[model samples]
Target: MSTVTTPKATTRKPPTRFEIRADIPAPGTPEGAYFHYTPAEAAEWLPFSVYKLLKMANARQIPYVDNGKRITFSGMNIRAISEQFTVEPFTKPARAAA
Candidate 1:
Protein backbone atom coordinates (compact mmCIF):
# COMPACT_ATOMS: atom_id res chain seq x y z
CA MET A 1 0.00 0.00 0.00
CA SER A 2 1.23 3.54 -0.84
CA THR A 3 1.14 6.34 1.76
CA VAL A 4 -0.78 9.56 0.94
CA THR A 5 0.71 12.99 1.66
CA THR A 6 -1.27 16.03 2.85
CA PRO A 7 -1.22 19.21 0.76
CA LYS A 8 0.93 22.19 1.93
CA ALA A 9 -2.12 24.54 2.11
CA THR A 10 -3.88 22.22 4.59
CA THR A 11 -2.63 24.45 7.43
CA ARG A 12 -4.30 27.54 6.00
CA LYS A 13 -7.53 28.80 7.64
CA PRO A 14 -10.59 28.95 5.41
CA PRO A 15 -12.67 32.12 5.00
CA THR A 16 -15.38 32.46 7.68
CA ARG A 17 -18.19 34.09 5.69
CA PHE A 18 -19.73 32.74 2.48
CA GLU A 19 -22.18 34.10 -0.08
CA ILE A 20 -24.95 31.65 -1.01
CA ARG A 21 -27.16 33.64 -3.42
CA ALA A 22 -26.79 33.67 -7.17
CA ASP A 23 -27.66 36.15 -9.95
CA ILE A 24 -30.41 33.93 -11.35
CA PRO A 25 -33.83 35.57 -11.13
CA ALA A 26 -36.53 33.98 -9.00
CA PRO A 27 -38.77 31.51 -10.86
CA GLY A 28 -41.97 33.54 -10.33
CA THR A 29 -40.59 37.07 -10.03
CA PRO A 30 -39.57 39.55 -12.72
CA GLU A 31 -36.04 39.47 -14.08
CA GLY A 32 -33.32 41.57 -12.33
CA ALA A 33 -35.76 42.14 -9.45
CA TYR A 34 -36.42 40.35 -6.17
CA PHE A 35 -36.24 36.58 -6.38
CA HIS A 36 -39.45 34.65 -6.07
CA TYR A 37 -39.72 31.97 -3.43
CA THR A 38 -41.92 28.86 -3.60
CA PRO A 39 -43.64 27.25 -0.65
CA ALA A 40 -40.51 25.31 0.19
CA GLU A 41 -38.51 28.45 -0.42
CA ALA A 42 -40.85 30.44 1.83
CA ALA A 43 -40.38 27.76 4.46
CA GLU A 44 -36.67 28.47 4.33
CA TRP A 45 -37.18 32.23 4.55
CA LEU A 46 -39.32 32.11 7.73
CA PRO A 47 -38.75 30.26 11.01
CA PHE A 48 -42.14 28.57 11.13
CA SER A 49 -42.55 24.81 10.95
CA VAL A 50 -44.20 23.11 7.95
CA TYR A 51 -46.89 21.74 10.24
CA LYS A 52 -47.63 25.24 11.50
CA LEU A 53 -47.99 26.58 7.98
CA LEU A 54 -50.27 23.73 7.08
CA LYS A 55 -52.37 24.43 10.15
CA MET A 56 -52.62 28.09 9.27
CA ALA A 57 -53.60 27.27 5.74
CA ASN A 58 -56.23 24.89 6.98
CA ALA A 59 -57.60 27.33 9.54
CA ARG A 60 -57.89 30.20 7.11
CA GLN A 61 -58.88 27.99 4.15
CA ILE A 62 -56.60 29.90 1.88
CA PRO A 63 -57.55 29.56 -1.74
CA TYR A 64 -55.37 27.06 -3.54
CA VAL A 65 -56.07 24.59 -6.27
CA ASP A 66 -55.14 20.95 -5.69
CA ASN A 67 -53.82 18.47 -8.19
CA GLY A 68 -54.74 15.12 -6.69
CA LYS A 69 -54.06 16.38 -3.16
CA ARG A 70 -50.81 18.02 -4.24
CA ILE A 71 -51.28 21.66 -3.27
CA THR A 72 -49.43 24.54 -4.82
CA PHE A 73 -49.16 28.21 -3.80
CA SER A 74 -48.04 31.15 -5.90
CA GLY A 75 -45.16 33.32 -4.71
CA MET A 76 -47.46 36.32 -4.97
CA ASN A 77 -50.08 34.64 -2.80
CA ILE A 78 -47.55 33.74 -0.14
CA ARG A 79 -46.16 37.26 -0.09
CA ALA A 80 -49.64 38.79 0.19
CA ILE A 81 -50.66 36.50 3.05
CA SER A 82 -47.39 36.99 4.87
CA GLU A 83 -47.80 40.75 4.71
CA GLN A 84 -51.50 40.68 5.61
CA PHE A 85 -51.14 38.39 8.64
CA THR A 86 -48.01 39.88 10.16
CA VAL A 87 -48.52 41.41 13.59
CA GLU A 88 -47.70 45.11 13.85
CA PRO A 89 -45.61 46.39 16.75
CA PHE A 90 -47.44 48.22 19.55
CA THR A 91 -46.13 50.99 21.78
CA LYS A 92 -46.87 51.21 25.51
CA PRO A 93 -49.64 53.64 26.47
CA ALA A 94 -48.72 56.81 28.32
CA ARG A 95 -49.35 56.77 32.07
CA ALA A 96 -52.51 58.62 33.19
CA ALA A 97 -52.01 61.83 35.13
CA ALA A 98 -51.91 61.13 38.91
Candidate 2:
Protein backbone atom coordinates (compact mmCIF):
# COMPACT_ATOMS: atom_id res chain seq x y z
CA MET A 1 0.00 0.00 0.00
CA SER A 2 1.25 3.58 -0.89
CA THR A 3 0.92 6.44 1.62
CA VAL A 4 -0.55 9.83 0.46
CA THR A 5 1.75 12.91 0.72
CA THR A 6 0.45 16.22 2.14
CA PRO A 7 1.16 19.50 0.29
CA LYS A 8 3.07 22.27 2.11
CA ALA A 9 1.56 25.77 2.38
CA THR A 10 3.50 28.74 1.04
CA THR A 11 3.94 31.89 3.14
CA ARG A 12 3.80 35.35 1.53
CA LYS A 13 6.03 38.27 2.48
CA PRO A 14 4.54 41.73 3.08
CA PRO A 15 5.33 44.58 0.68
CA THR A 16 8.15 46.93 1.65
CA ARG A 17 7.47 50.66 1.99
CA PHE A 18 9.19 53.84 3.15
CA GLU A 19 7.75 56.87 4.86
CA ILE A 20 8.85 60.19 6.42
CA ARG A 21 7.77 61.13 9.89
CA ALA A 22 7.80 64.33 12.01
CA ASP A 23 6.65 65.28 15.48
CA ILE A 24 5.73 68.91 14.77
CA PRO A 25 2.17 70.09 14.43
CA ALA A 26 0.60 71.65 11.35
CA PRO A 27 -0.49 75.29 11.54
CA GLY A 28 -4.06 76.60 10.95
CA THR A 29 -5.43 73.13 10.41
CA PRO A 30 -7.42 71.42 13.13
CA GLU A 31 -5.69 68.08 12.58
CA GLY A 32 -2.36 69.49 13.82
CA ALA A 33 -0.60 66.33 12.68
CA TYR A 34 1.70 68.09 10.23
CA PHE A 35 3.55 71.39 10.19
CA HIS A 36 3.08 73.16 6.87
CA TYR A 37 4.63 76.42 5.75
CA THR A 38 3.86 78.96 3.08
CA PRO A 39 6.51 79.94 0.55
CA ALA A 40 7.29 83.01 2.62
CA GLU A 41 7.47 80.91 5.76
CA ALA A 42 9.49 78.06 4.24
CA ALA A 43 12.00 80.64 3.03
CA GLU A 44 12.75 81.55 6.63
CA TRP A 45 13.61 77.91 7.33
CA LEU A 46 15.69 77.64 4.14
CA PRO A 47 18.75 79.63 3.05
CA PHE A 48 17.00 81.62 0.33
CA SER A 49 14.55 84.46 -0.26
CA VAL A 50 10.85 84.07 -0.95
CA TYR A 51 11.35 85.18 -4.54
CA LYS A 52 13.89 82.42 -5.04
CA LEU A 53 11.65 79.97 -3.22
CA LEU A 54 8.77 80.84 -5.51
CA LYS A 55 11.06 80.54 -8.50
CA MET A 56 12.30 77.14 -7.33
CA ALA A 57 8.75 76.04 -6.67
CA ASN A 58 7.77 77.03 -10.18
CA ALA A 59 10.76 75.10 -11.55
CA ARG A 60 9.90 72.06 -9.41
CA GLN A 61 13.26 72.21 -7.68
CA ILE A 62 11.40 72.05 -4.40
CA PRO A 63 8.37 70.04 -3.37
CA TYR A 64 5.16 71.81 -2.40
CA VAL A 65 1.41 71.39 -2.33
CA ASP A 66 -0.94 73.83 -4.07
CA ASN A 67 -4.58 74.21 -3.13
CA GLY A 68 -6.06 76.42 -5.84
CA LYS A 69 -5.02 79.78 -4.29
CA ARG A 70 -2.09 78.95 -2.04
CA ILE A 71 1.05 76.83 -2.16
CA THR A 72 2.33 75.22 1.02
CA PHE A 73 5.39 73.16 1.85
CA SER A 74 4.63 70.24 4.12
CA GLY A 75 6.12 66.81 4.21
CA MET A 76 5.84 65.24 7.63
CA ASN A 77 6.42 68.72 9.07
CA ILE A 78 7.92 72.17 8.37
CA ARG A 79 11.34 70.92 9.43
CA ALA A 80 11.09 68.06 6.95
CA ILE A 81 12.31 70.23 4.07
CA SER A 82 14.63 72.28 6.24
CA GLU A 83 16.24 69.15 7.61
CA GLN A 84 17.04 68.03 4.09
CA PHE A 85 19.67 70.75 3.83
CA THR A 86 21.27 69.94 7.16
CA VAL A 87 25.04 69.46 6.87
CA GLU A 88 27.43 68.11 9.46
CA PRO A 89 30.59 70.05 10.32
CA PHE A 90 33.75 68.20 9.45
CA THR A 91 36.92 68.44 11.54
CA LYS A 92 40.46 67.80 10.29
CA PRO A 93 42.24 64.87 11.91
CA ALA A 94 45.42 65.65 13.86
CA ARG A 95 48.64 65.02 11.88
CA ALA A 96 51.36 62.79 13.31
CA ALA A 97 54.66 64.47 14.23
CA ALA A 98 57.26 64.23 11.44
Q: Best candidate per TM-score, number?
A: 2
Which regions of candidate 2 fall more than 4 Å away from where they truly are? 1-35, 75-77, 91-98
Give each model's whole-structure lDDT: 0.49, 0.59
Candidate 1 wrongly placed segments (more than 4 Å): 1-28, 31-39, 61-65, 89-98
Q: How high is each candidate's TM-score? A: 0.43, 0.46
lDDT of 1 by residue, 1-98 (tens): 99998877657542121212335344346541344333354454445555565566667655332434444444555556667668999999999999
- Cα error, candidate 1, residue 85 (Å): 2.3
Worst 10 residues of 2 by lDDT: 13-22
* lDDT score at residue 17, model 2, on the 0-100 scale: 15
